[model samples]
Target: MKKVIGWSLGIYLVFGLFIAWYLFLGANTDIPAQLKGSPADPQTFMNERELLLSEEYSKIKNLLFFLSVPFEWLIYTLVLVIGISAKFRDWSKVSAKFSILQTAIYLFWLSLLVEVLSFPLSWISYNVSKTYNITVQSTQSWMKDLLIDFWVNYALMILIVGVLFWLIRRNEKRWWFHAWLLSIPFSMFLMFVQPVIIDPLYNDFFPLTNKELETKILEMADRADIPADHVFEVNMSEKTNSLNAYVTGIGSNSRIVLWDTTLQRLNENEILFIMAHEMGHYVMKHIYIGIAGYLVLTLVGLFIISKFMSFMIRKWGHIFKISSVKDIAVLPVFLLLISVLSFVSDPVSNAVSRHQEKSADLYALEMTDDNKAAVSSFQELSKAGLSQVNPPFLVKIFRYGHPTMLERITYTNEFEKSEE
Candidate 1:
């Protein structure tokens, strides 16, 4: 046990120091010339006030983002300690007497504990968003959404944990492989139903009422080789003032959705640029590619968990009151391993997403042939969402799924320059 603890501490310390150095000292922070515009130009995309607000907003948000990682690790560690000390093993044994009811109770309590521990951070995040004028949802509405999120998450956790443990009990050695196989179908199922079942639970969705804008978007979609059909508008104004458009689902369940705020806020040309970018994602099959990437990552993550979990359990099972991998009390330990792995692998994930986004940006430029619109659209998006035009390189590597606003704008300018 001491050896295992020593190994874990050593690895964490080395990794933590390396990450800190990479983020603060080693990463590039340069902005390309194409992205820099003269203040003397009358058509400077971002005004002085916008740039100042964006810088301040990014600083606050980035600080919170970095701080939350350690806070979450501490919270999860505390939960594991408390769960073990609180007789979770005895509780699991008693609950098993009632069949699967024990799994349900154990998961419910565990989830509730995590939620309670996490609520303060969540509250602070919401308040910060409000303070920055990013969100418009009232306190009551936000709380309602939080409650809804909890129950939905609990329900899903119950299903996943129940099935996962059943697999482990059936085949202790290869359960990880089987679990990975099962996750593929489960992920697809969630993707298929989310647009209809899950999303509507939080916000209203309806066919876009603006016939003129709908027609324009459909025309743009047609140019991008996406099927022409209805465009859905979500009532995001009820919750947020930020503008966004997205493509969701797969095959027949697939649809393009625009926020009502985007429709109300952006000009037709800017909206066209945004729609084209989303269509680029669909036409390029990014969603399918993203799913494939997830499949690979999950397989690798599960394999790692399988290899180490047993050794750890053998060494400290008594201390944790967990006797086997099949015990529900081990869930927190499993989650802790997963959380650590996910953080370690975030750079790979973010890099892939950034590549896809960059491709989409280029596709939008080609499809729209409106460099000005494309650049202006990103400028508007950054201003409205309070995005940093020049995010630190470490933030870009770890947190950014798309190129920074400046990067996108610079790419557009470079593309135009090449053509000229």
Candidate 2:
């Protein structure tokens, strides 16, 4: 028994480290030369040869965005199967189940790793952009952006991970049940407080200045039964060139935030159309529905995990560097389970969100009676983000949360045609 435990422990540790190194080290090596940061002057920084290499890299990136998910899953499944098979004596019927667990761990760890390694990731991304003269500034600005990301993400994880672990340990297999229960209060608090607490950690916000824009936004809120709080602009432009706008908070405190980039890039009518779409989400009670969906799924996940808890802990427990059943570290395994559920559940989740976005679009179109403005907004988003002109169907299935640009354009054009 002692020997079995020791061997299991040894294998798990070796495997864990191998996985971590592969994810980080292997990923870094793949950074394309074109993706590396370079000087602003095309002549000074990248010669004609470098320019050609960067262009090739851009082609690869377009391929990468499509290929990344499948490539990741294949590697993930391989590692997971090997890890589980080495640990457990009988992983035949239970192999599929454990694979799911492995996938979950892969995603959570990968997500964290990506975030933790964002410094280099952003640097490479920024440098690549600079090499192509696509980026706005020097490599120093890229470092500052990376630093801000590192701190913001580190803080958010710390704030939530500790309590998340506590919840899993206290409930064990029923951790999902407890988490769902916890999420209720947490969701409420997050709605009311996250904008105040979490938002400020990364960026600053101030009341919107344009009186005409402010009045128009407020009127839309009133019609939608949303109260006026404070409309503000997030200072995201200072960090990166991406454009975004969002509605945050719940009830009386709910505020609309338009990125300064969004304001600059979009016209008043387009802005109003987007706002109306956001208002549709508020009216439909999507937030409340989301809370319910999370609770239900969590309960199901907890029930599944409860059935296999003992075998899991006994088999792969040593890799965690903990002995007691009560040790909080094992919660990572439970978290891995949630991660799997969340990933697998993306299609259903995306469908729900996509429906809400469509509904919002419909509401916006009706309210504004400006089909051209909605089309313009979509065009601006695609241009600003350099979004794929037409993403693959499989990519759409597992990844996108909203309708494709093609779909949006087609739908809006159909509406205009019907009107004509």
Evaluated with lDDT, which candidate comes out highest?
Answer: 1
Please give, for residues 1-420, the per-residue lDDT of candidate 1 as tens digits.
Answer: 455455555765675666555545655544556434532121376677776676667666766676567556665555554444236546766767864778888877777777887788788889888988998899999999999999999899889988999999999999999999999999999999999999999999999998998888888887667885899999999889899999898778898999998988888888888888898999999999999999999999999998788886798777776778877677777888888899889999999998999999888888778888887778778878977777787788779989877678777766652354
> What is candidate 1's CA lDDT for residue 303?
91
Q: Model 2: per-residue lDDT, tens digit, 1-420?
A: 345555655665565555444433433322225523322122333456654544344444434343333333333333333443223323322444543344334334544544543334345556655554445555676666556666665555554555655665576555556656766677778779878876776678888777789889889888778767657888766665557887787766677788888888899998888888877777877767776776777677667655545566686655434454444334445445555666678788888877777777887787778888887787666556544433544446566778866567557645642353
lDDT of each: 0.80, 0.60
Regions more than 4 Å wrong, model 2: 1-175, 306-309, 318-325, 416-420
Error of 1 at 230 (Å): 0.8
Off by over 4 Å in 1: 1-35, 38-43, 83-86, 92-96, 417-420
Worst 10 residues of 2 by lDDT: 35-44
Q: Please, what is the TM-score per model?
A: 0.89, 0.68
Q: Quantify how close model 2 is to the true structure by its C-alpha RMSD in Å.
A: 11.2
How many clashing pairs in candidate 2?
Answer: 3
